[model samples]
Target chain A: MEYIQIANSTPMWIAAGVAIALVMFQALIFARKSYNTGKTIGMTDTQMKSAMKSAMITSVGPSLVILTGLLSLLVTVGGPMAWMRLSFIGSVMFELMAVGFGAEAVGVNLGAGDAMTQVAFASAVWTMILGSIGWIVFSTLTADKMASVQDRFLKGDTSLLKIIPVAAMLGSFGSLVSGHLVALNKNTVAAISGGLIMAIVVQLAEKKELKWLKEWGLAIALFGGMIVAAIL
Target chain B: MSDKRRVYEKDYLPYIVRYGKATGWLAVALSFGPAVVLAVIYGVLPPSAAVFAAFIAMASAVGINWFVEPISYFPIIGVAGTYLAFISGNISNLRIPAAAIAQKVAGVEPGTTEGNIVATLGMAVSVVINIAILTIGVFAGNSILVRLPEHILEAFDYLLPALFGAIFVQFALMRLKLAPIALGIALSLTLAVNAGWFNFLPGRPTYLITLGAVFGTIAIATSMHKREARRD
Candidate 1:
């Protein structure tokens, strides 16, 4: 009857599996739809496959990071919910913080021995759910609308409109990089090395028509950047 | 409208909108279900008041991110990706970078319809592969993590900066002039925020830095693009 037992229960695992299945189903359908749409719009199979390959490789390192985070969540919230949340709709940091807040509200501490009563478990669940509800609800309401709103502003030549996304990419990414740059830690070394390596690799890829190298460009930069930072 | 835009915006987008809204609500329901199921089984649902308190605490902590992240991210990921990314979570670390690499390998630009399609497909592949990795890790493969050396684990701390560095370089190389401006604006604002100059603001300083970088870079870059086109 322990709450932790319920957390790692067979029913919990079923729910987790079902939830992850839903996510995978949606992804499959979207991929199929996009692939078909791409064919109509002049995308070759090679290009689409290469994009998929690049994404798969780029995802491996970060996904491993998430997996490492999963180890922590396993101890805190048990395996099922942690697996479901990370697989479907939540990040490690948000879930961990919510669990902490929920535990505190009930005068119990998390990961501080077995103070997790049934109510404490429910409280944590409620906080995680309600906390993240805003995103799904907001997207339900606004995801469709935002794109058209963007399209409205970008009504001119579509070619010229390309600048909008490019600038947004730089701007969003610039903010991310700038944070590390100002921190002046190993992160600065990591970021600079990644950027510098990318600059060189890309120049070489284009100049020499290194298709294989170009395809693996970001993955190389990612690990290379980290190795440089680690050595420093 | 251009042929490409017309196909995406007119012919294809409505279908995405339909799928997005339908599945978005389903995701909300699925995500919220586990808490209720566990509570009902234990017959120890936290009292409504306690649940409300936990909800309030979480909302206050991350409420702004719920609204802001989707909007900021929509530009790069586009419509299908908006639904897919928000529903699946891990938007910044996994999804956006997945899209970026896919576009790079496929020789597509981020803003165009083609890039959007490529990004969507790439993200779909990433989620599938990511889930496969997590499934193994949770069930029987976290042995993979426990055996790693301490220094190797330390490398992951730099993963974010390294990934960001590479992505920023890609977009910056495309628009060399505007990249520095974005980095400068973001660094100043972020440093100012770090210095406690912006303590009065709501939510994380990241939003301020990102919004500043994105909007500021967009304004300058758009004008520069236009003027260059005019001369040409």
Candidate 2:
């Protein structure tokens, strides 16, 4: 059978499907648990639903952005693996590089179509699997401990407690921004343009009482950044 | 903290941690599904040497991040969220923005119990939504994606920077003063790295800038907030 045929085989689909289904099942369970817990914490019906709605909307653009990279993965690994991988821990760059490393090990260059032997494909798959295992292992071992650490912090003074999350978020975002602003490239334009757009839109929404605008802020900012990057 | 909040520490978080551990370990195991099938069923194993080479390459590139990134994201993501985000991945580009927007619209601050509930809930929603979109994009995407204008597809590249910029602003706007501080620290660190000051570091030291920016901003801003409170 052709390599692509096997790549898109029913068995591969089933393998991919089961992993994805587990993720979906876990998500549903967590979401429900959170909703029940939210009620106890004073997250009202309106707040819960609205947050979900806002998240749902916010996810659309980025999710679509994930999709835009799908073509590369599809050609590289076929539909099922691409679907499973991208839907889970796989980023486009990582997957591509892992595959390249795998193919290179077997002495293949990852050129267009049929250049990938079964052994090379196998190598790529193994590389991706073994390569990403550290995260899962490290996270599983330490997640509960990490949760405990958070517990200690939560018990700290109320005034300081409030400041930690806010400051952490600001710093996290600052680091993200610096990554893009490393040089004056399209990314810089996108970040600056997007930030400017977000500021304007948010201010306008607040002043004009445009609740819908507030909800759609991320989508608007993402698209605005994309447009500016494309233009400039 | 009030009794309402106490219930979170006493009742809610414990269950999430326990459940998260069980499911998180399960995900680690399940992540190996496709690779096993490719190896066992297809008899497509590569040479052990080739596999080792791939391992070296993969590890050299992103190994430290497998552990480092998750721990850094703990403050914003919370307990349940750490489980879900790490398992499902795409924490920055997709998950964080989703959770941030949800909390923003709902007017909940991160680090607090209520914020954790909302952030986790929001992230859970994002995981399901992301997979759903990818599912569709995989089966039907290629035909449609190929037909879309190249210019539009090119536009997708900019969404990430736009997202980072907009999200930083979203959180930065809340605290106001820390915005410039975080940005400045991140920029200096990034520039210093670019100038080869940190070449002695292993793998990619630029990655550590995210940590520095996050922890540095947290320390600086928390002190500022406390100092101002004392003055008041």
Candidate 3:
């Protein structure tokens, strides 16, 4: 009983302190920036609280999923390897969701991909790169069009006509390959192949204009990459 | 609506605000204390059994905090931080010296009791160290939370598809091109069916999944963009 009590009680306090510290630090930094810019935080205290709550809600489920998965996997596997693997998985999960939801938020045709394959380095790097590319390209080539889409999404009136294709494309290629590789215990190759596939697929899809078909082709290549990477 | 008129008034605060300070502290308390207790037990308990017990206790705390509602959210954060502390300690193998010091300072049994007074202090020290490192580690003019080394950063490059895939589900439901969606699915299925074939990559599953997501996103994005251009 004594042992159990100690194990359970102390960490909570410690974590709370850390969380508070983090929150405070970020808030202070932002506040300073706002002051220097001659602009106040737009939200009232109430609005701020609401926003935090909403963000917490949005982020909590995913965080829990990762936590539960991590704890279970840790217990079963135990040690640095498990930690590394779980970290990789968790990072991918968050990145994918951020992209998918972010695309819709902006009303762009930007899509998302698989949750599992995202554990590889390729997924993280490419998403950041492609996301940046999307930001630049859309802003340069179709600023008004993108803004219009963003307004529509913010108004809570998005059309399914635009989203399904995006999701499908995002889901199709490199993620599948990465997921397969990880499950097969080939973490490194998965990362490499996934990255390469992303570069190729993005470039090819952009040029071919047969995006849907290209997505399929990329998917096939991903699988083939796995076979070739794995067998050889 | 005037900027000057906006005072720090609270209209609707979260439960954290409503609960008062002590209650909030209690929430934090309940979540993290158990992990500390478990760490203390690691001393006396056999290595195998100790690890098992520690894991179970940690899981319970994590579970309770994670699945429960906003009312219980704070505790989860607290506990998660604590678990992180324990992991940090375990990985560092900081058991004996820390345990001895804890027993001396708190006048508690080293391996017995819940480590109510002593182990808590010891773990607290560990937490402080962990946080301090994280804090100072954040350099100016660069990422303040750069946890990954260069190698890991390199690894992150591969995870793009996986991240996007996870978000794909949450991508807004809108009018979408069925062709891209269909193609994406077809490709994913093919890869999954022949997952065994992709053994060549270093990171098999992660690679496969990342590959899938990258191509998937590209496929959809390009198709939709082209179609829209055609219409224009």
Candidate 4:
């Protein structure tokens, strides 16, 4: 479907340009804000750009590889190949954007905004997947050893794990609802709205301690599943 | 040595561990029967799309846990419940799990952990009903009802949007993020109006639409904030 288009016609130059623009945008904002606040880290723009370039180089490899794997499979088989590619790509980007939204949701719910503000938004999506895999592995294996890692990173606190489930729920919420939208024939809008809903809800749930987070998710799943089945 | 640190460390571990164990167990039990049901349907329904749908459902079920709020176990409930509803004719199959999911989304624990047990029992009962339906749907297939082509089945994707719209609207009203709520509506509407226009988006049209909607809303919100700031 769309994946084939991406794999074939997607100008790496264009994709690379957009990715670089995003990196520069982040660096500029960070630099300006830090300068205005007079809390100079003394790092030069050149250094920052160098670091950003290297980071993108490392991460884009995995992302593109994954993208190829996701898109290519659909074409090989010949069904709605475009749909599958698009869904997979949509899911990845949504996951990336959700970090900001997730942070907002958590902040609203727990008054954890200040802490969230300190979280580096750059490279966040990669960090999250990496972190989660790390946590899952650590938790499942040397549960106690992982405790030390948590303590070290969190400055001797590990209660963040309690919040892990909320984040996971948000991801699923975004993906499935977005999937539903894609299924329902409202592609782009569905992905964006679903992603936003997830981001904001997690924030709302985190701050206000809303109980319906679980409820709405279940409703979406069951009702959505029913609708899927009915149409099929 | 202080109580805060101790609470964050020792006492919290046992509770978190217990909760993790409980959730993990709930997840396994919820999916077991659904997997079996899908297998049966795979044999009987004989749609190529069934494989994709089943893969998505299972992936969404498990993958959702990684990204969304795991504090609530309703994904498990929904996963199990959907299969049960599919198997059984009972509408009640929709109720408890739906309620449970809704409750969690609201940020309230679903009455008690005891609700999980009740949900499981309800689902088990639905499975029995499903078996009965399977018998009827199979025997009555060609002689009893009309059939649609495979391509038309793809349109069922919209159910996700409808479900998300209904749920998110309710959630947004509660949280007071009227802006995002409005964005959700607008995005869904746009997709409905110009589905083909989104084809130009990079990966998937759905995702492009989503990104477009989110950023578009953000721009609008930013301007609104600027206006409010100027007024103040």
Model 1's C-alpha root-mean-square deviation from the true structure amounts to: 1.7
Which runs in model 2 stand beyond 4 Å of their true positions? A111-114, A151-155
lDDT of 1 at B2: 65
Tell me the fnat of candidate 1.
Answer: 0.78
Interface CA RMSD, all predictions: 1.4, 1.3, 23.2, 21.7
Per-residue CA lDDT of model 1 for B98-188, tens digit only, reads 8888888899887878988898998998899889988888997457778999898899888879989998998889888888998888888
DockQ of each: 0.75, 0.78, 0.04, 0.03
Put down candidate 4 lDDT per residue, A63-118, tens digits, no spaces: 22223323333332111222221221123233333333333332322124333221
Q: Give the lDDT of residue A49 in candidate 2.
A: 91
Q: What 10-residue stretch in candidate 1 chain A is worst by lDDT?
A: A153-162
As for model 4, its CA RMSD to the true structure in angstroms is 22.7
For model 1, residues A59-150, the per-residue Cα lDDT tens digits are 99888888888877887778888888888767999999988888767867765764778778878887888888798888778888886788
Per-residue lDDT of candidate 2, residues A1-232 (tens digit): 6667777888889888998888888788889888998997777998889899989999999999888787778987888888888877868998899999999999998754439888888889888888877777777678778866865765665666667777777777888888798868999999998888998888888889776787898889989988999998
lDDT of 2 at B2: 87
Best candidate according to DockQ: 2
Every model's TM-score? 0.96, 0.96, 0.28, 0.28
True contacts kept of each: 0.78, 0.81, 0.05, 0.03
How do the residues B57-81 of candidate 3 rate in per-residue lDDT, one tens digit apiece? Answer: 3333222322211111111112211
Over the full model, what C-alpha lDDT does candidate 3 score relative to the true structure? 0.31
B1-232 per-residue lDDT for model 2 (tens digits): 6886788878877888777888878887787788888877787779999999999999989998887788888777877887888888899998898888888778788877778788888899999889988888888968979899998888888899998999888877888888898889989988988888998987668687888888898789767977997899
